[model samples]
Target: MSDAREPVTGIEVPINLKYEFTAGAALARFLSSIREGRIVGQRCPGCSSVYVPPRGSCSRCGIATEEEVEVSDRGVIESFTIVHIPLPGNPVKPPFIAANILLDGTDMACLHLVSEVPTERVVVGMRVQAVWKPREEWGYTFENIAWFKPVEGA
Candidate 1:
């Protein structure tokens, strides 16, 4: 009997996934607020922590966050990195700054793009503000704010 056999090789399987995502009440409210050029978050009654893009409950206290807090587009960079590699579907070019921004009046930091300044100059605690797209381009998504930039003299 022949003992030799063909070597096993991997097969490429293309996946096509389609589904509907219903952003529940908490997120729906957040989306609506952003659509109107406002940033709103829910305050946790238990721990008094505010969550932007508000999760329905508080991670620390495990309680419902009901109080809506309006936060400024301005924030401080808690941390950041200068991305030098390009992503497959990301529109933003490489060599850009991506940051974890602690928006004013919120306890948690949100991820966002930083621009309009030299990458070498971006630092922790640097104040930045949202640079929104034209009003006509506003939508129910965070993309409405094109990116964040350093706030002069801040």
Candidate 2:
């Protein structure tokens, strides 16, 4: 018997998914602050750890975080990786710096793009600051900040 392969036809199904969830009380406040060009964190009364993008609850002590604290836009890059390949839906273009930054006076780090500096020059502990988009573009999202750039004299 001769081995013959059958061609398989692929069917593409388009699915449109739409759903929304309330960010809850804590996160809603955090998002609203972002829309207003402010960075806020909640401090845990138990451990005194501040969380950017506040969760309203402390993972360490299992207690609710109540005190809202404004953090600096400038932060130190805790780690980073340069993307060399293009991927769909990537906000920043290829060959961009994606860094985990620990904001000043906060204990947690967040992931964001780093621009205005050479990728090769990106280093851990390097100070960076948010490069916000036009004020008109600020909405109920973090996209208001276009990307982060290294701070001068930092």
Candidate 3:
């Protein structure tokens, strides 16, 4: 006896709600950090780069970041680009400012929202600080801090 096979045909399927890796240590740290009103990052002693939201290991050095670096609220704006398109899931008012900030004391730069100042006022060397949101609305997301604001001095 032999078996027959079906001819080649392309069919599209949709993905519905499904279960997944819900929570773990990383998530717990996120919750804890928000409640304490601080931005924390993990660092790899090998490469000397700190990561936001903390990571178990370093991507470049291939080692664990056992040290937790308390990043300064202020950082220098390394680079940025103006965004003219508005897409779904973006809560910011259109024509907002987004940039890569080389945070103080860390060798890495992270992308985040820039605000509290006009878009035209922003520059590459601009110094900005982390502006935290109210304690009540501190969720598990990075939005705990509303945006980066221009620092008063240094």
CA RMSD for every model?
3.5, 3.4, 7.3
Cα displacement (angstroms), candidate 2, residue 153, comes to: 2.0
Tell me the lDDT of model 2 at 20. 89
30 Cα displacement, candidate 1 (Å): 0.6
Assess every candidate by TM-score. 0.89, 0.86, 0.77
Which candidate tops lDDT? 1
Clashes of each: 0, 0, 0
Question: What clash count does candidate 3 reach?
Answer: 0
Give the lDDT of residue 85 in candidate 3: 91
lDDT over C-alpha atoms for residue 150 of model 3? 91
List where candidate 1 sits over 4 angstroms from the true fold: 1-17
Show the colliding residue pairs in model 3.
Answer: none
Instruction: Give the alpha carbon lDDT tens digit for every residue of 1-154 in model 2.
Output: 8658776678788777889888977788889999999987899999999998898999999999989999998899999999999976675678988889999999999888899998778999999999999998899887788899999987
Minimum summed lDDT over a 10-residue window in model 2 is located at 2-11
What local lDDT score does residue 88 receive in model 2, on the 0 to 100 scale?
66
Per-candidate local distance difference test = 0.93, 0.89, 0.78
Regions of model 2 farther than 4 Å from truth: 1-18
> Model 1 — TM-score against the truth?
0.89
lDDT of 3: 0.78
